[model samples]
Target: MLDTAALKEFLQQQLPANLELLKSMVEINSFTTNKDGVSRLGKMTAEAFAPFGFNADFVPSLHPDYGDHLVMTRKGTGTKVIGLISHLDTVFPPEEEIKNNFQWRVAGDKIYGPGTEDIKGGTTMIHLVLTALQKFAPDVFEEITWVILLNSSEEVMSHDFGKLCIERLGADALAALVFEAGARTGNAFSLVTARKGRAVYRISVEGRAAHAGSHHERGANAIVQLSETIQKVAALTDYSKQLTFNVATVTGGTVINRVPHFATAEGELRTFEREIYNCGIEKLLALSGKGSVCSAEDGHPSEVKIEVTQESPPWPRNNGTDRLFSIFSEVSSELGLRVVREERGGISDGNFICHVMPVLDGLGPNGDNGHCSEQSADGSKEQEYIDVTSIIPKAALNTLAILRLAQSA
Candidate 1:
């Protein structure tokens, strides 16, 4: 039997110290591309769990520009494992952080910072939960080994990190919990049960360059043709099927006078269902071919090429995920917290690990305005913030949830 009242009291007592740690973490900028900064934050995070008997190891990324992924493991008497996942990186670069003047700030119950809502707070929440379990529920803490994965390139969607997660904890893990920011509506908080998959594509066009004024008709305009194709591509978005296409970046033409020889556009496709995802991919790939630009009375010398740069599969809700949520919700009700299951559109590490083991996400603090940084006088343009009050209760909930999961297994 567990003492819920005493556990809640312990979490409430540690609120101030946990908030201070979160502030310290927010002060350090851990942009995905900043290897040094990300590594520094990883070092600090690893030290926090060291006192609880976790041994930390840094795995180098596939590319040298990104920070090494941090994996911390605490051994237990049993071989069954429970994995907790979070990221150390934020979307904001050093320049954006400086320009937007986005640092940690406290006002009433909200703490605004760069990575506060997206994930840094989630990592801090992990520390708080494990600390509570170690002190209050010692038997539960020792029942299963804990595997903590804090990848450094989650903001940019690193495929290697997904593989690393499976290689480490996929074999015998009981359940994987992702600590992305949670959502609170009225009295109930939301836990993510499913997430949409995403694919990135780049389209390149080749044409002939010619003088604008002297030989306009003799030239092949790649930019114009690409723009026309982009319209067709953007029209692929179908709200009915929950499929969306975004033409993110476009680049074409060297000068204003000449008909440019090259053009390119980058876009993304996202969907909840696998059938829709595959269908969208097929249509996007089929668009690669010749363009409607001609070369001086000859045949059209323009060509288009489409490439899928990266992809992450969707994690649809299933029996396994529902069972995990049922277990978690029972614990929440016992602790006086109401939780609801949600299907989020954003991608996370759960999308990769769900197939390896049953996964549950949104186990972190509640907040809004995840990637926004600008601020306005009317309080419309809001920066990212974490609900200061939700931290302790969520930590207590997660602590009890983990305990019940281990004991039930």
Candidate 2:
């Protein structure tokens, strides 16, 4: 049996040092576009984890504008490998942080700063859990290989980072745990078991341009055709399958007096099931070049083209995910930490690797108001923050659960 009380006490004693580390990270602006800032934060993280026998490998991003992805590994005596996932970037820009004056501020129990709850807290949680495990559960720590993946472009949705994770962790990894900020509601804690996938697409329509008054009957109106097609795409949304589409942007004519020759629309689709997402995609694609527009008998017909700009495949909850959740639940119950599983509509790094292995996310500390820099002195407005008091219990919970998982595997 593990000494849960002792682990908690040790975590409590180390909270100050952990906060200091978190403060240092929060002070550095690591916006997704800020490659230099992201790399600096990754270096700091590597130095922090070096004490645990982990070495860092900096993999360059496919995008030259982004920072390199960090893959840190610690070899153990056993064959089973466990993957830990988090992002090094936040949504807040340097100008935004400075404009809002949202530096590290500690209230009664809340710690407010950029990236405090979204993900940097999650990275700090990794260090805290490992510190406790190294001190109290050294045997378990030495029995399994630990691979940590820190993304530099998660906010922008990773295309190369996902492949890099699979290459480093391999498909045979025991499980992947994502630290994306857990939730504490009253007495129960929540961890995410599923996340919805997302895809963005642009539709372009081309036709013959003409003057509205003089040549209206001789032209094919592309904007009118696109408007009719947009309704078809929007109608594909099904609430039962948890699938939906949104036509986010539209641009076409230079003036109201002309029949536009070209028009374009952009939108996104989201769902938790791959089959449903694929079906929706197929239906959307089938609509290309199938709609009607006002055109003369001899006029050129309008042509429609659809292209996918970006996509992150869905991560649905399955048996493997449930089994992993059960392990964490058992360990939490043993340690008097009651936990529940949650299905989130948001996507994470878990979506990329869940198919390769079982994935359990939301393992970070409790916090609220993510991606916002607003705050009010009268407690009216909210800002990004982590509950300072929730850190020790969450660390203890993660430490024991990881030990149990490694032992059972």
Candidate 3:
């Protein structure tokens, strides 16, 4: 039912062109905040898909800095609707240093560039794969409904655009394929079927201020209370349950001479289980509700509040997820590509789609150092890159996987 040989040959023939397309994508600094660059990339993407009869429209971003979401739809009479999700935004901002911003380059067997492996490669391959399928395998392409959501704000989290896009399209989706960099290879599961959810909180404390030199005893030190609270809050992280809590920022008090009246601590919570995540939240809220000893005889006061800033649910490895991975693995093995499974703590839009359908993530080309900007002092080398050799191999694998999925439907 699938033509693995023809698909491999098509991918091989299109490798050069796809690489150039990825180069252009990496060169365009579509940072989450660069509205202009993001919109420009969206236009370019729309133009690319237009030749294939995809009707593209820009969905206004809930926030201005994140640009807009690109939704492309193609008519098909298939049994189920298939969703392809990827993001165009990179973590590197536009005003950042040239070395840190978007700059495409070829070094040895790898492509050294920002967003190269993180997802530009994935997005490029999806375009190429779909394009090829539409041309060489028209029957397979016409057998299923296709919805493509190219998000522009994944790096800084959804900022509501991804949510709205999913709410709009996910209701009809039976399955989704996320084009993120796979974590590892040469293993049995090689696919990302599960990821941890993330929850962010801002814990604040308030206390009476007083002059440090004259009335230290009269002053209620909010900073000191917050400092002790940070430890108590961080202590809740349970590694056995794979729950983590980290205090990322703490701020209070302007001048050292005065006792601080207000202080705040920001932290993140991650977990692979929703129940565990909720348990941690309850503990954090309870901890934040009670303050440390200050000036009162009651010792700890009740001037604390914990607010959930944002959250993303964990995507568990379930039967449906395993089925998707199995299909992809069979196709990949047939194509002679490495296979491995990754269970990561990082969450993605795939986590959201799991609510409606089984989803697969990190199907991008094999590479490492994603979202890492670590560099030498002289800025000559980069910490991020995508293996040039794996580009078409993985893309070909995805092509076959899609064919298999369509056949099943």
Candidate 4:
């Protein structure tokens, strides 16, 4: 019974203002470690969310340097609760933003900035959609409980604190929506019902060092041992199971003349199936033998250590998740929008919340070019961007989706 026309009209009317707000947000470098900047953005967001009947409260994280977590709630009359999850942090450091001359640029349909696509746009749209609903569709808005968790350090999922916020806020909720940006292409929205879990680890190898000319053969060659280990680890990835292993970083050999005494590799594991995911984790941990056969020349064992640095469980699909997607997809068809049900290889805070309750993700702007802080292979400064045209419609879609879910519940 919600008025779709009025919702779309309200969004269209406020598009320019919302874009301006996005520009302001993207300009502030809220890198995970930039605690002060994240807090400032959080405060500004709380102020912006106030007019929509949301009571904003700041929850301190386990550490002060990671910035404070934000939870905003709007009371309603219904029994069911719907949660909106988003993050304020970007991958770009403050220095990188300035070095790359990161600024919101309007070019045809694209809005170019550092955090525009990664999720700053998503955060902006969340506030805009709710504000529009309160003005044009109060009945639907006031019918169900609303819990908005604006977290910091999602790029890092830092210390499980972001997950902690979701656990705290959505413990009583029926469903949740994550405002992460959509696909790597096109403007049609994608509803993510499932995501791959990830585990990051640092592997180190220690070996005997010796001079290259005097006693090169005496050294165990840590770099060589690490190379073999990286290959074995990479081979563990199975495409059919949607499991992938990547060695993201490697460090070894300080100088050309000497066999290095220490070498290390940092890598990640991503998979969708929990059992398969756990098996891989166990295997990875087992690779950390105190002494492993690292070299075949002399059959000498080397000390290899693998320590998990971070982890996030996969967001598996369930009956409730399927039902939520059906509701959202129906609303999308009604709005003349094409929405594809997607299972993502990348994990988000949704993965954490899905453990407790079903969740819908990727309800943000659509564009590619995210997760960039490095130059392209061609050496041009790679920029992150999002489709400006996608914003209003996505905001509209999210607004209608929430209202319909709330009203029906």
TM-score of each: 0.95, 0.97, 0.93, 0.90
For model 4, the run of ten residues with the poorest summed lDDT: 290-299
- Which has the greatest TM-score? 2
**Model 4: runs farther than 4 Å from truth?**
184-187, 290-300, 373-382
Error of 4 at 259 (Å): 3.6
lDDT of 1 at 56: 97
Reference-based lDDT, each prediction: 0.89, 0.90, 0.79, 0.81
Candidate 2 per-residue lDDT over residues 326-375, each given as its tens digit: 99898888877789989998889889888888899999999999999987
> Candidate 4 — what's its lDDT?
0.81
lDDT of 3 by residue, 1-409 (tens): 5576776787888888888888878888887888898998888888877877789879887776678889888878755778888887888766563755436667788887888888888888788889778866788788777888888888877747557656656665667888898654453225788899888999888987878888767777888888888888889989999999999998999898897889999989998877898998889888756565577533535377788998888787787778888888787677766566687888788877676677888888878777766567786655678887776677777777887787775
lDDT for 328 (candidate 2): 85
Instruction: Sort all candidates by TM-score, best to worst.
Output: 2, 1, 3, 4
Give per-residue CA lDDT, model 1, range 116-208, as digits (tens): 999999999999999898898787788778999998999888889888998888666888899999998765789999999999999999988
- Kindly report which residue stretches of model 3 are placed more than 4 angstroms away from their true locations once superposed: 97-102, 168-172, 184-189, 296-302, 377-381
| For model 3, the run of ten residues with the poorest summed lDDT | 182-191
The superposed Cα distance between candidate 3 and the true structure at residue 333, in angstroms, equals: 2.9
